[model samples]
Target: MNDQNRLPDVPLRASICMATYNGAEFVEEQLASILAQLGPDDEIVIVDDASTDDTVARIRQLADPRIRLIEAAANQGYVRSFEQAVRASRGGAIFLADQDDVWIGGRLDAMLEALATQAVVASNFDVLGGGDRPPIPRLRAADSGRHRANLWGIMVGYRAYYGCGMAFRREVLPSFVPVPAYLHESHDLWLAILGNTAGSIRHLDDSTLLRRLHESNATPRGWRSLRVILAARVVLLRLMVEARRRLRAASART
Candidate 1:
């Protein structure tokens, strides 16, 4: 690329967006793995959700110019944190990362390749310590582009979509962002909904990262009350309706 075509002083190829909250124990390792995959132009955009631990200090210690950290004023949960990171990022490719997971080798290239043709791409992951994957069904490559079916799988609580394994092209930022006011959690599901509704998602069968499961993991570990479960489902249903509306508006403009 020539200087005239470059993106100012830094031409970012990808931005790995991370949301952290008191994740000092494993953040450095995760960042180390991520940094290795990124080019000099690539960056890691982090939104610290008022972490009480040394997560901020550790990140600063790495001192890599590629990292851009944003400290939130108050704890607004992971969904808002991720939305902030995504909005702040300037890369053409945006990746959602957890503070504790390790990116497998080739993950960056694979996701970038998938994103080249699709608006959103979600890959699979294995447990860091060889633990069994969650009981939910894994995403299949053959299911890629099956938008209606995929959204239905999500509504029925069978689809396994996690933020750590998800990324999207920058063009889709408008569709994914400004998260619903009522969505307290499961931002990953919301992204998946938008991607499927647009009919532009790729489901990769390859495991792209090593997810570290622990007590402090962001995902809830216990079963919720029936009422809470039903409430969450209702929120997702609302999101589906919202995604359809957003896509319709976008189409009308074109």
Candidate 2:
């Protein structure tokens, strides 16, 4: 571990914010994979949402000084837990992590390189399932085609951004955090929408993560009910309106 006293008080280069809940089955593996990629200067900020399982114990077993654990008083859902973790991070660039995924080697380097040019970037990832499943499609940004002029439109329409493969610079934090209570989308998508409107969201071609598929995933599996679809549409409309407002404000400043 790097000596903290010798380091400056300013934010570090990379701060990974991971939210975990009852993920003892594979959390250790995920942590080991990520920790191996980080430098002595990098840090991982983990927020556990009151896991009843041995997840906390397993994480503590790592005993790495770079890892900081924050135990939530109560069980907040994934969105809120992630919000807290992000808030607690002290890095100029933030990476999101899921407790069950295995990060590919060089993931941090690739993301940091992208962040040099883009305010927010997401990379491709291979899917992993138990017992040898076929390869899954790579995660990519949607092709806007005629809607290329509107980045937010492409994001809202395709919903392709995955948080596990995403990272963003600290400059975008103001627009990304304190996630709107009314938005029905996940924190990743909301940040993507804002990044797109800011003209700094990008998709890297490299696959830097192994996204594990399992029953414990917080993402909905298949088709959703009509009620869910309608709610999502409403949220999308609201997001679009806000994006437009911000764009106008930015244009005026320019």
- TM-score of each predicted structure versus truth: 0.95, 0.86
Instruction: Tell me the tens digit of each residue's lDDT in model 1 across 1-254.
Output: 11122335554789889999999999999999999999987889899999998998998998887888889999989889999989888899999999999999999999999999999999999999897878888899899978889999998888889989999988888878788899989999999999998999998999999999999888886777999999999999999999999889888888
Which numbered prediction scores highest in TM-score against the true structure?
A: 1
Whole-model alpha-carbon lDDT for candidate 2 = 0.78
User: Which residue window of length 10 is worst by lDDT in model 1?
Assistant: 1-10
Candidate 2 lDDT by residue in tens digits, 1-254: 33333545766889999999999999999999999998877899898999999998898888898888889999978888898889888899999999999999999998898899888887777777535322334445553122244444433445456799899998777666677777534777777777776767667767788888888888765677889877876776677677667657656766
Query: Which residue pairs come into collision in candidate 1?
Result: none
Residue ranges of candidate 1 with Cα displaced over 4 Å: 1-11
Each prediction's RMSD to truth = 3.6, 3.8
Task: Estimate the TM-score for candidate 2.
Answer: 0.86
